[model samples]
Target: MKILSKNLIKLRDIKTFKFKKAMINYQHVEIVNHFMKKPLILVINCGSSSLKFSLMDPKTGEESLNGIAQCLLSDNANISFKVNGEKQVLALLPPFDHNTAIVELVNFITKNNLFEQITAIGHRVVHGGEKYHQPTLITPQVKNEIAKLAKLAPLHNPANLVGIEATEKVFSHLLQVAIFDTAFHQTMPEKAYIYGLPYNLYQEHGIRRYGFHGTSHYFVTQRASSLLQKPLEQCNFISAHLGNGCSISAIVNGKSVDTSLGFTPLEGVVMGTRSGDIDPSIIFYLVEQLGYSLDQVNTLLNKESGLLGISGISNDCRTIEEQLLAGNKRAKLAIDVFCYRIAKKIASFSASLDNLDGLIFTGGIGENSNTIRSLILNQLSLLGFKANEQLNEEIRFGKQGNINDTTSRPCWVIPTNEEWVIAEQTQHLLINKGM
Candidate 1:
């Protein structure tokens, strides 16, 4: 009994010593983080089949890490990234999902000694409905609200929620903020958002046009304002975010007064697969005359239409452009329809503005495709837009500059920075909330 008691006392003493040492180590880590490390925000944007992440210094707008996990939940799932300008790729094993992807990302950050500097996590939520008008800190109620709004943005919100939940588990000690894509468009007026449906239906069902890609739009708007040397509130321009998914917004005094995307992303200009602005009667005709179930019709419109449907080739603009160069008639038709629709939408949005300052273009197609830009600009000659062929051709592949002639209004190719906007907003929210 005496020997056993002595051993127990020794065990207790050792535990106490270890505890004290751990506390000292923790204090040292805190001191180093405070003095040596700049607070970095980890921005996450999760799609249905992909997850994009970036570790950024919000103050300096410098990205330490940028990557995407593509083809999730499949055998070929892999992640490609650049850490401090060095590129690398890693394949994931089977049974990987968002949670697994996040864990791997956290492990990668820790391995590279960058985890200690990440002070918070920011999620790019696609829908905030009317509940969130700005960047909001995530809570249980907020999660529920985002989930509910998935009905409005099925392809986006649920994935965003999954990312948020997974990130919460992996970074339980860090603050998580949701920078919504719809939040910046909340400034839109009632007349601009209201539909022509019955008043009660809109009021009761919460069915109104809620714009998407607001983060991208807001980012380019700020850049345009800066380039034009005008205050944000004084800048009036039409910003087009053209990619696989397209939306155009009319910015009056830096606020979105009207936008092409309506209650859903499918209501705007033609997208990769979505049939934007189809006659409602066509849906009824497909159902009653063509023998299509509602689900099948939904799939057809959202997944099998647009450039792919018109070209009968591929949804990718680059591929379509190549085919057009090869004198493919269907490809020409697809390009013509795409450019005409966008140009028509831009002209319509001009009615919402008193004086057009300039035109801004950003996104995948907008930034890279000078051919499409020139084609669209040619259609807008009446609006005083004359594309400088040399300048337009030069300002692509991560280049940003005016692509307009000296006598015409400015047309810019500002690369959109949605991730930076998310990071900066997350930092600002933390500072405001004293977190």
Candidate 2:
């Protein structure tokens, strides 16, 4: 506890915090209680308009408390949380920002004395650019770097920094760690991540493929490697993270060799809102020939395209599936495009591997929607992935297990625990730094 006090004192002086010190892990070493053995790690992820948090046991992957502040900064802003097993919802009055939300959450934690045993806070930052490649202790300069990366990921990185800054003020004494979603993909080789554009654009603008959904892909890869009874460093597979925002990773020997998303997350397969892979010419055409501005073209590609764009309805797969059953042709077309694009990407990623060991499905649609899985697997029949009809039908609504038949390569529907990944990385860094 004395050492903890001394180390945290350095953080008190903002002017003295260096960039190099920000790269090092800051841990508070104190004799812990023998009665309650496990230390708690708080993981936080902020979307453009929502904040999700979890209090977890990093050693056991156990979550004691988890929740989300949804519809943030709006009239309908509310927090839905679970304590142990019981669930509760608290509505916040209008105009609640991240700072106000943090104040409320901190008060709740204090009322229950939850912060007394917390060892560290792990924040899920989306874009690290070329500056950060691993988890780092949060500092003022590190926060500024995160803010600067907002130019690359406007919808995500800035909002992530907000959560980090708010949590810093609330839990000022505890160590705060920033875990980048792009960190796991740092192992990707240049040949796989490079674009075919002008060399100067790549050198000067930092415009190269930086994949997203990395933590989820990494977690599911580890789980799949374990289930296959092979060492993680010896496993090869394709990981498809199917959610509102989706990406597929080609992991060879447990390292991400290639991924679907590029430069930004807008260059991959079709997502809920984003038009994943439209030609660059279309943007120029829209601006010059269709009388639209650059900003409007950007909005059309990122917000008005993909599933919603095709179906002329909701971006949700479930809703589209319902409409497909109701004989909606556009809805069927939307789903067909979604599944086909994923299948094509998975097939293409297999070319990057020497030999395929397995294929993993994760995230919301991958874990829950059996129909989507079947649609995708049916297109990959040439690759010997025969998803068992009964197994796919059985695993629904968060149930995870193998969904392949005897003659097929292993296909797993593992529910991803990205928060657990963040906590594990935080703990591993602490151990490596001899905290």
Candidate 3:
């Protein structure tokens, strides 16, 4: 393999307009710039069953278009989008796959002339192992490295690659970038990332912790630092990102000291379906004693457990809360367990830092669900973290504010912008390469 130098080009060497004129296909560049006064970056975040995308002005972080292609490869697969403020959903034909869905997206953008303004594309890859710590321009070499690292993230990286492949087919002329979710957590010390398994396994096979949801954690840390009037490098925080897939991060001096999700997204606080931090012996017990296959066990842990397993109704927190209020014991238990795990992780992560500057709540559940925030903070109130109930109640639906009393430690409800982070990284890489 040919080695690429770390600093191949510098941003100071060229201007963006001149770079665009020199690098991009002349006809497409003319059409792209003619329709927009600002260069737009397209960000893609792909999952097993969904594709989320956004078009944003990288310099201002202003979004122009955003949406998702959900329930892929299913009968109900659909594309939902909003452009310039109007929203619509289109039910795709049956047998819709990632490539077809991406093609549909491209058709819509081209039909509306939105594609002309897009300058570059950014993709979110979940795991990078040790190969990547920074966002990289997507080349053939980088794509091969991503495919090799899929062994460490079988579920996520594969789907991420699907998005990359699909996007490349439709937007061949624009530059593509890969932003690894594991890159930010590469700063974790050995003591935190190393597992208590055979030393040879870790050495030869890379069987160590590579935390997920790092993009969300890093974005919140930067936001929290700004809200607290402190430099990012001087901040210390415990960030709880609660959504379909949840994880908490302990950030020290702006770097991830530790995080909840492990080598995969499955090892974290209980998420919508994933089982987090369960006993390793359970797998053996199921396979050897109860007559289960390894694949079945994997499916159970990754898809059928967590709130869904416990509540026996739905995986959504909102649905669980509704059932709990209607006097369901299992729903209550699921919520209790979820809150307990988050509180426990917060306590443990606090010890990782000399002193906690503040706590940030983000992601879907963390930002919108006041009940979850109150429950988690109440568990930590004895340690000088108290939530202002009225304040918590008022902050929801993309609103951000401090939800803690003046006498207590700072607590913020900051909605995460993972797509924006990807765009920022993509733009920075382009600028550095003098493109």
Candidate 4:
């Protein structure tokens, strides 16, 4: 049975909170969860410009508080947080980087006495190269290895490590685990992962497909199997995670047999900004034809392409949808190209698995946009799939609902909790050292 209810965590039942608050008011001192040894774990997803955190009970699946510190390195840095079901805004502050952002979180946790209960921390490290196949405890050596992978994922790994270092300094006594985005896709066979490039490049530079969004893809597939009441080993499906960065995964049984993302997130479906699955010659062509330098070309592929490039308006899917509704030509073009690429990849991934049991949509765009879902399903009636429009629209955010008809192949909107997946991995890998 799941530990948390569908509703918000009741604040009144929290004996610790009431007791601590009462003590603070009457006794003028902070109270800690010193009596309990069960750890209050912190799961952190450190991104380039934002830090998302959650305090979760691993065994119970109940969460205390979760929130995001966004717009880092800006004058208008903001902290948007939610405890139970209520949301609050913290004081607006100065510019902060990942390190400073994490330091502030540690301060918040400590001032509120959360640090006393925390026994460990889990981090979502973006790329693990070929070294880490599973979640491993973060040691000095492991930290160095992760640092080395900064070039492979310059946009993510470096910032991820910054959060790790800052948190380690504050919670030096706690056990910490590093969960990697590429870990779940390590099951991909060479037949599915290896590129047709020179064998020497593959051996020398570790240049091969390392699919991302592993945490989200892994958890959703397991949950889908449970929802269908089928053994995951018997389930063959394609899972799509369509946020700013989009990826499609082909799961055979319980494991990821194949996925759309390659060595970088840039090698998949057209995303919010990244040019996905582009021809290699296009990079060279842009340099010669447009008189662009390598940095200029790289910036175009990574930051100037995708929806933002097509629309010339916004990076957000919701904004694009709004523009599309208002009949903006560029917005319509951006969306058309996005869905077309996704539909094309869905077909290619389905071919990887001989038997297709279902197509699951997730992440921001995949979970919310019934329009996108309908458009994709329109081209796939041959596969006996059609999304239930009402259900798709109703349960767009954090609510679980299937979009497929009773006889149709299963399509679900299973809200993702990558933080929970990181928490689970952290717990499984660590033995309780007396807290």
TM-score of each: 0.92, 0.92, 0.91, 0.88
RMSD of each: 6.3, 4.6, 6.8, 7.1
Residues 181-259, candidate 3: write the lDDT tens digits: 9999999999999988888988999899989888899888998999999999999999999998999999999999899
Tens digit of lDDT per residue, candidate 4, span 1-435?
121221112211333322222212211111223344556679988877888999988777678778898888888787766776988776556756666666667656655656556657999999998888898989999999999999889999998998898776555545689999999999998988899999899899989999999999998898898898999999888999999999999999878988889988889899999989878988778888989999888898989899999999988989999999999999999989998888888888766787977887889888788888888876767778887777767877677878887768888888787888888878888654222
Best by lDDT: 1
- How many residue pairs clash in model 3? 0
Worst 10 residues of 1 by lDDT: 14-23
> Candidate 3: what lDDT?
0.87
Ranking by lDDT: 1, 3, 2, 4
lDDT per residue (tens digit) for residues 1-435 in model 1: 454344323323321122232222333434434654587899999998889999999987799999999899999999888986889999878777887888788778766767657778999999899889989999999999999999889989999998998887666556799999898889899999999999997878889999999999999999999999999999999999999999999999999998999898899899888999988999999999999999999999999999999999999999999999999999999999999999999999978999999999999999999999999999999999999999999999999999999988999999999999999999899879766
TM-score, predicted candidate 2 vs. hidden true structure: 0.92
Error (Å) of candidate 3 at residue 385 is 0.5
lDDT of 4 at 235: 89
Cα lDDT, model 2, residue 186 = 88
The residue pairs in collision within model 3 are none
lDDT (C-alpha, whole model) for all candidates:
0.88, 0.86, 0.87, 0.80
lDDT for 162 in candidate 3 is: 91
